[model samples]
Target chain A: MKRILFAFIVVLVSVSFAKNASAQSEEELVQICGMIAKDATFLKDFRIKLDAGDPPPVQRVPVILKKDVKYRFSVCNSKDFEGKVVLQLFDNNRMLATTYVIATGKDYPTIDWVCTKTGAYHLFFSFRDGKAGLAVGLLSMVEMM
Target chain B: MSRRLLYILLVLVVTASVSSCKSCSNSDDLSQDLVVPDSIAFNDPVPVLGETVIEEMMQNIASPVETAALIKGLKVPFNKDFLLTTKASEKFNTSFEKSLALGIYGCDLGYLNMYEKSSFVIDYIQVIKRLADDIQVGQFFDFSTLKRLATNNENLDSLVTISQQSFSRIDNYLRESNRPMLSAVIVAGLWVEGSYLTTRVAQVSNHKRIRETLGEQKTILIFLLKVLKVYEKDPSMAKFLTDIEKVKALYDDVKITYEVGEPEMVEEDGVIVFKQTDKQIVEMSDETYQKIIDSIQKLRADLTKF
Candidate 1:
């Protein structure tokens, strides 16, 4: 009886976990990315998805930034976690900065950066106390100073 | 019976790790020829792309938007004459040619869309649709909506955004479908065509920024070669890879150097913006630069041949 009860509990937990782990559909993700692209100051190039899953698969992008030009990095999410995902920028292993978190626990929607040194930079994405894949990030260069 | 349960549990654990592991310990050594020197880092030893992560590299691949912005910034005239002719897409009949033609016309569309040349947009959209349909990605496009967005001059960004979203869908679909070689080919076509456009402008205008941009493609070439090397066994892919390898050989002598400097942090709109002070400067001889231009033109012509 105990063994059967344990199996039932396991099945119930997995069903609940799978429900939370569901991914956004392709159409939904594309729309989310398109909405994020609208505000990019420069011709925007890529749309990245961040989910807070079991291990919360962190996404890293390698970008070659040019010197003296300011590039803006922005984050957009589904209505559930729009401003909650953390976007971290790094030069190699060293952490440089992250998106702004307001006093009310909301994050600033975008990060504007200037490249004084031209080299490869890594941008890491994750969620704050949320399920994985809850947010999407948009990368664009703000052409004007 | 006990062992059966153990096997299942072991498989489950292994599957979870493979799906979530972020470390690069699993990557086989990349081709030695494709490695970029520290002064010119182009790739990291990242794992195979996940379905969603595939779009991340779309940004890394030089966007048509970059060429559009460059042309606009240089005050260069919007010359439809400079773009690849729409009918040029019809010349190719094979899956390879059709795939590449899709890429070529796709870049041309980027230029046209950026200029908001309403008249030419439909033709290229038709071309892209035909090619994408040939390639089995037609479902990604929303024809009525794109046309609706295009009719309004102010909807340029939205129209383009929708278009860009389609490309992302292509990447996601290809990755999920386990046909990443096609994805690699599409990206190769996009990069080569975008490079061709830039070099063409550089040929006529001889603008320094354009020239610098052209030279910097050496880095993007490294990135491309790394991706292509993964599919080095496909005969068609092998043939294309060989051609790009030649282009890489042309870039062997072209050098890019970077100088490190103090990083900067600025407050913008209540957000702290961090700036890197490191500078990248390209040094290419007039002779080498010309050689690259000629080589790219010849290579593109060969690839685009029907």
Candidate 2:
């Protein structure tokens, strides 16, 4: 009787521990260049990518978008680089957006936009004239719940 | 032997049943305690993202040209006469010099930023010169005229009323219209930048000896506050207003604290010592620094809000 009771207690405790661990592991941090909406609106995200000038290192940020939603795009730099990072979003070889982000070293910042058309879009981050920095990131979109 | 085995089995069954029942009851009680507030529903989508409404509201209220004109016209007097003649003035002047230098630096960057991004062609240097002239002459001030215009003269009882109206219009437009997000973001950036300038000016005034002689800071604050008040009525403007309020509250606290002291002199080592409390100045500077950071963050967020 004592053996059966001890085994049941062990099984319950292990089950609860597994449940908690799985719950925690599922919550992951995702950085994305933009989010897509149900209406096919695209938002572009910007980040400063450090490149050593070879094949171009690219960081992919996860983006979630619904099938039909309106979206826009914006860009920002870390506070230390205020007045340093200049981001431009382009669509099909045309300039869609540009901004000179001034960061004051105390806030988490990102640019925002609504996606209007649904397809692959390219976003480019470059240093302004007389400024130098490397940028590498892929602009991806996902479905939002 | 058979009777003993049955008794043990029965005991085990009872214990298991009672434990499971207790667990079920506890779960039920927890569910009962989970009351949702009226303001928020489980089905209602959380505001993880939305259009940059604040930026849109600011743009709807006025164009950049109109805003620049308003800013230029709102100039207030910056004079030595208003300072604690010996100590406070000297310190104030020193700080003012540093601030002016910083302003110039920011202006330089601003001009560059504008030049790079703005499709509208305007001579920024010329505008800066005009701004300087307005500052020195102390006529055709931006804030004063803005207050006047906003109030519609005697028809409006107070600047606050005009602000409220303007805020409502912009706010409504943000909610009701499908405007370009970039436009809204740009407007918001300009507003935040303008507010930062105003707040910094106020910090300078807090150290001044004369309360009546309106410093650059107070003029900007009143002007910006009025503009902000106009936006408060709209939901989108309301968010921006919250940010402005945070900055304003900090400014007010510093202003009140600084005003409490009387300008007094102390003699030390054969030289008459005149001072405004260093503690106050430092505190005010710190607050200004923090507010600047907050403003920058808001500005960055605003830029993205399209």
Candidate 3:
């Protein structure tokens, strides 16, 4: 009887700890969004679709460069939806270069771009439907790598 | 009594375990609620146009008289005489120079704004590349000289280049961060300023002259409205559009005052002083001036996000 009681107490403690950890992970994702929104360099737009079943469509922003430039990007996903985001970069006319960002803990997956052409480009982010959410951070483009 | 106590203890432990299991199951729900969604639906992709083709088109579109008026409304003292003569007046000079710089900057910035918007519209409407080409040409301005001037000094050039490059970097950051809407807002903001300039120039000029020079105010307004309509669909642009509306109202008020009455004829002292309500006109001009200043400050604040 004492052994069963001891096991009960242990399980309860672990469960509480798990809940706290989950909450922390969720909070971190929100914090990432806040940080990105506050950044002065990158323009930002976000949308949330409440319904389920359909994979959320990737939002594409076209960039025109007068000169060739290199770029870097990072994306972080919530713990509940880690390993769900796929980042894609396109050069001018829909040429897809796929990059994967594996969300571990709260860290964003990062990608680098060495743009060789002076033309239009599109950046795409694909996330898992329903279970996962994403936050993009640390986007930079410069003439030099 | 012992049996009863043992049963109660077992019941308590079982109940506690069940509750804990239930809580663990609910954690997923809690986490899901807090999770940021994976993707946001964006407007369709905009068709891309070649830079050379776009440049050629803009050259064909002659400078409208409204363009000059809009430049004047910005109150940039671009004339070398105005800048040199006014140096002694620090307050006036500083204000004039800043407005001028911003006006120039705004024009350069308008290129990107028009590009993104026209591209988006083209993509969504599946319009032909020629239409996109036309719109792009209509909006393009040659900034080669300005870029050279801004970057003339080695030290200043590096700084200016850095600042301009930062825009692209920041744009990349937003894209990576799953906040394309914010970027879109920034782009839309540039368009709003451009549209405002177009509208201001069109309305402030004499109707007959404007019609002769730049077609009509209605045509310009329609073009601007189309741009605004595309931006209005995005959630992030709501505040920006509101700001644009405020400026538009001020412009309308200025127009109403200017067109309210018939031209009055007044004779003064010895000269045939046509009863021109010049004073009233000046006051109205001052009001419009204040509105422009307020709008610039508001725009700067909105742009701080980028």
Candidate 4:
């Protein structure tokens, strides 16, 4: 009887704590996504949640990019894991731009690329050191001057 | 009682407690008895539109900002008559109509916000909430917060952003969570209404940019039709598909050709950027443009009315 009671208590407490933790993290990511989009004129980001684990999977979003349009892509994650995730833009196997670099100390937070060719392009994202985190990718047009 | 009998009693108590707690939470979510469809039968999974097609299609949306900016630049008078009526809110009783109406009013909300018409914004917010509530996605919108924002003209940008975010969040949830039928219907509502608003403006203004902007909706409609086709098995969706097919046929002859231009390096907000130079030329004759406008107007009027 005592063993069952103890097991029930543990399970109840674990579920409660897990629920709160998940809610807080999800809430924080949503706030960050809104902040990133506030000033963007054209690009609206699709807020996505990712977890870090072994055999890290990159968050890949594929879309068609039109020729002769300047698209600006920016990312903002939870402060706990800022500068810890890398975001890359790809066309087929060709790497277009990314947010992080080693030994260069140049982490471009937002990547601005002009699609010179009209075709399919990909935005790939993954966390460094398998650190699970929440992130938002914002896309917009460079103002026509 | 025997030990086994006592154990069974304990298990029953625990299960009953958990079930009661879940019901309590569900009730607390919304006071209104929303007909949120719990069992939407589907024959197949929502097909993925070949890599990032959704993401690309999202960006390809006919932004009210562009439409509003052009209308402002042209100094066109704001026409309230062009908007859908509030009385139509009660007509959306089913999940299909409710979801589609939410998107339908979403276009009006954007158009009203962009034109800086603050007075009537809250009315539409209420309609959106009622429709969203009917669809059971009311949780995505903070109604009181949106109502407050709509009343203040200063928050027009925030209002637009919040509403857009709300729609985006719902779209992302439905698509990623494998509920693409609802997503498709909502998107179709938004497009039909948005294109309707743009075409309404184009009818009165001879500006090439507005006409060109409205013409570009052909691309968006093509993508939207592609998404809806995935859910063609649904009976209501089957009916909706026929309407969309009519719009596509009307847009069939409108040609949009892009000419490649060199990338230009420019500095914006102290950051150097490469701007794409390719310009789109929409070869739309007066008759084609007029037909497109007439088709969209008729389609939207019918959809919003019935």
In candidate 4 chain B, what residue range of length 10 has the lowest lDDT sum? B27-36
Candidate lDDT (C-alpha), each: 0.66, 0.32, 0.36, 0.67
Q: Evaluate model 1: give its lDDT.
A: 0.66
lDDT of 1 by residue, A9-53 (tens): 575556555544544443454355545534563333334455556
Score candidate 3 by DockQ. 0.03
lDDT of 3 at B281: 21
Ordered from best to worst TM-score, the candidate numbers read 4, 1, 3, 2
Candidate 3's residue-wise lDDT over B206-251, tens digit each?
Answer: 4333222222222233333433444464443455566556655555
Clashes per prediction? 14, 38, 20, 5
Give the number of the best model, judged by DockQ.
4
Sort by lDDT, top down from the best? 4, 1, 3, 2
Per-residue lDDT for B117-221 in model 1, tens only? Answer: 877888888888888777666666555677777665566776766676667566556565555656677778877888888878886797788888777788777
Chain B only: TM-score of model 4: 0.80
Candidate achieving higher TM-score, 1 or 4: 4
Worst 10 residues of 3 chain A by lDDT: A43-52
Q: Could you arrange the candidates by DockQ from highest to lowest?
A: 4, 1, 3, 2
lDDT of 4 by residue, B1-306 (tens): 456755765675576567656754554334234443654434445455544555444433444444454566677788888888878888876677887888788878777877878788889989988877666577777777778886656666677667766676666656654555687788778778877877878878887767776677776676677677877777778888887788789777888787756555555665546555556677767888888888888888777776
Candidate 4 yields a Cα-based lDDT of: 0.67
lDDT, residue B132, candidate 2: 23
